[model samples]
Target chain A: MSYLKEFTKGLVKENPTLVTLLGMCPTLAITTMASNAIGMGAAATFVLICSNVAISLLKKFIPKQVRLPSYIVVIAGFVTLISLILQAFVPAVYDALGIYLPLITVNCIILGRAEMFASKNNVAASALDGAGMGIGFTLALLAVGSIREILGSGTWFGLPLIPEAAQEAIKPMTIFVLPAGGFFVLGCVIALVNKIANRKPPEATGCAACPNRESCISVEKAESTVENTKKEENK
Target chain B: MNKLFVESSPHIRSAWTTQKIMLNVIIALCPALVMSTYIFGIKALLLTVICCTSCVLFEFAFNKITKREDTISDLSAVVTGMLLAFNLPVDLPVYMAIIGCFVAIVIVKCLFGGIGQNFANPAITARIVLMMSFAGAMTKWTAPFAWKEGVDATVSATPLAAETLPSMTDMFLGFRAGCLGETCIAALLLGGLYLMFIGLIRPATPLCFIGTVAVLSFFYGGCDVNFMLYQLMSGGLILGAFFMATDYATTPLTTKGKIIFGVGCGLITFAIRQYASMPEGVSFSILVMNCLTPLIDRFTAPKALGTVKPKKEGKQ
Candidate 1:
């Protein structure tokens, strides 16, 4: 596949976060902060790119029987290398990434692509795929992180979004930053995006045939007043 | 021929209809509702009625505008109303109960694809939402009538309050003021037992969950063991374990998985109550376990009898 295809595929079709549902642990955990997103994204991207290329090179030498352990050793090597470099140079990203950096060896996205794509593909194709995928994963992490940071922490990339006085007035949605909040937001995003992409008429089950339609006067009262007319007719 | 109406997914249909189950649930919460009003005074009764009415109205309006299938006839709106009332204080401002109703029946319940499809317990989520929005009102526990009004209007602590712990007996008897359905043990148990009798819920989740909590409390809970019993009886445990945690869409179907679900709920509930800063743990624990239901179901699949013991072909 062309390099552009390699990159764009990861962004949408093979998206590690949404489409493939890989690397969910970090995707769900670190996305709580934009800074964490950027940092975690970059770290995972670096590990992914390196791991993919190395795995592609080693694909032939490793026997089919022990290919999993084979891939792990190579991935572990890259993860360790990144961990050392982060600690030596940028200690903060290292500290922030915490044990998660080491745990990257287990991230399903990395191992999945290595097993499914890179190990079978040429070295050049594997590298391009890695960069494409790394960027895609980074984008997802950043997106998820930005949402959480703004809503949960009352900040974006650590900047205060709410005014200082208003901050005290309005309680930050503490749930947004929490683990369950991560699941809720991700679920909503999935449900909403699926609705748009599928373009099926919205599945209806609530107020249309309802007996209390006259009393139920709220925004969900719907656009097509035909529903109201019919509700009244039924009444 | 393309059909004009189509029932959606999980194509498997049980004998139970949504409306019947919901009616059963409302019945389950009724004892609590009645007992709370009797203990807390006419305010609790009025608050519950207001919440129930507003919830039904909100569901109606949401349906009218959305042009979806009318859901109020199913009594889901009623269940939401009753659950909301159950979660709230009798002393709460009427409009706040309306807001709670709106959040329960509208935002949390409807927005997430209505009724069974909602990710969390709508009442609990709404309660939490209200807790955030009106923390003061949510926590303002009124003392019982004490047979005089102005004499003892003091804002004494809830039974959960350590310094002013109601006698375990009083808490069991529903004499103190708390959330509408949560203050009374006998009422909640009666409601739970009624639900069990109706078969809206399996006994395993509530029984195992409560059982686990009792044993763990004996070993780990710092409070008196009987206090743990009172704690289990007092708050939203009955409502959550029987009604919310066992929500069909959110919980596992198999018997063993339900047990594991109950155990997980129990452990998390106990952990939160014992270790966390919060006074209650039922809602958080149920929601957390709700998230894990899919994974639990995946693991606890009942082994097919034939698969476990493959019959020998002609040779046998």
Candidate 2:
């Protein structure tokens, strides 16, 4: 049940793309088409899961100072493997994904999970976390891609949805396939997710999850000390 | 018995509330609206009506769904709709116009915390989005008064995109093919003059914006006055400078900031018109400058009274 929770959490509550906003380059670039989104998502997931497991297994062997470089080595190997497999069989998707497929080695979700989860957890839990995160990223990409595709191109997965006559009356907004449309759709999707989840903004939730919490607290303390000295002098 | 009143600062009351200001803006827009209707015929009026109605409806609906205070009474949405309609081609499909309204009122305005809080002018942004989305439809300008021939509207290029320009009088009177409200120099100037007269908008931004464009185009056209005037009169320059660029929310606050913002807009517009593929750049330039308004305001902020300037370390 705990493992399942780890997998389920990434789908909505801890979505890397929609919630945490990780790996935005691929999320914004390759999501013009639903097929490209799935291809990139699947490729990233493979790399993520493999790297997570491998990093978790080798965590004990790696020195703490050089763990990030060691993790990159693991991730690069998996990314290359996936790239070769896709190139060998699904050449069309390989071409469509192009540079983004190989670029997955440095995707923040994979590295983030590797650093934040795999290094600290056992292999099974790390693999589950990777899977959940990878799936979440894919689902978010898919949602954005589908919206852009349907509205921008008047099609779903290259199948014509708008009739020929209707197409003349109202041409599909080609901007949806453009980079601007990708941003618009992504923003709207994130807003929708936030609405559905009733999530508080990061500020309202406080500094517990903030990466800069310690530094921020120290700064606040320093400011208060200065203010205290000033008040004493004034008195 | 005498009545005594106690109050805080700002004891002076004025008749110019938000609704009254918006109403004044609508009244100012009437000249251009009337000119567009005269030039483009009934379709222009119909598009304006549809855009205004849809914009108000979208704002009302969005407010209801978000359970925020009712803001439709301010009439800002109607202004946005009218401005968006003015930006659009007269012959654009009704659905596309409605989509633009949705973008203006719902996405750009309400989603960003409503009217005064919007980062950019909703009408301008929506027009740009519509231009990008429906490029073919957005650019397909119909010749002025083509409907009066009792046949289908003949497609024609706007003055900016045309091979040979129309006579100055024709262009000035708005007998040229262009976006709904942009062709008429006379009507737009009339509206701009009214806004300035009523003190609804300061003259600094619009004057600087138009002046910059005029100066740049003059030099770029090899100091030809006719060419400079044509450049100034063409496209959405006058309409944008007076109405959209001077938007109170998106533009800078201080006089110095407004001047910088206006000059920035003019430079971008000049660059895009001279070098870029797009024939017109008023909307794009204004949008870019709108994003820089906060920075301009920050840099141009006035020092409060009695505040000493920081001493230079090296000089000290």
Chain B: TM-scores of all predictions: 0.87, 0.94
Query: Model 1: clashing residue pairs?
Result: A31-A145, A207-B63, A209-B70, A210-B70, A216-B61, A220-B65, A221-B65, A222-B65
True contacts kept of 2: 0.86
Error of 2 at B105 (Å): 0.8
Candidate 1 off by > 4 Å: A53-74, A116-125, A192-235, B1-67, B89-156, B167-177, B184-233, B237-316
lDDT, candidates in the order shown: 0.77, 0.90
Error of 2 at B167 (Å): 1.1
**Candidate 2 global TM-score:** 0.91
Model 1 preserves the real interface contacts to a fraction of: 0.00
Q: What is the TM-score of each candidate against the true structure?
A: 0.65, 0.91
Residue-level error in angstroms, candidate 1, position B64: 6.0
Go through the candidates in order and give the clash count of each. 8, 0
- RMSD, every candidate, angstroms: 13.8, 5.7
Q: Best-fitting candidate, measured by DockQ?
A: 2
DockQ of candidate 2 (2 decimals): 0.77
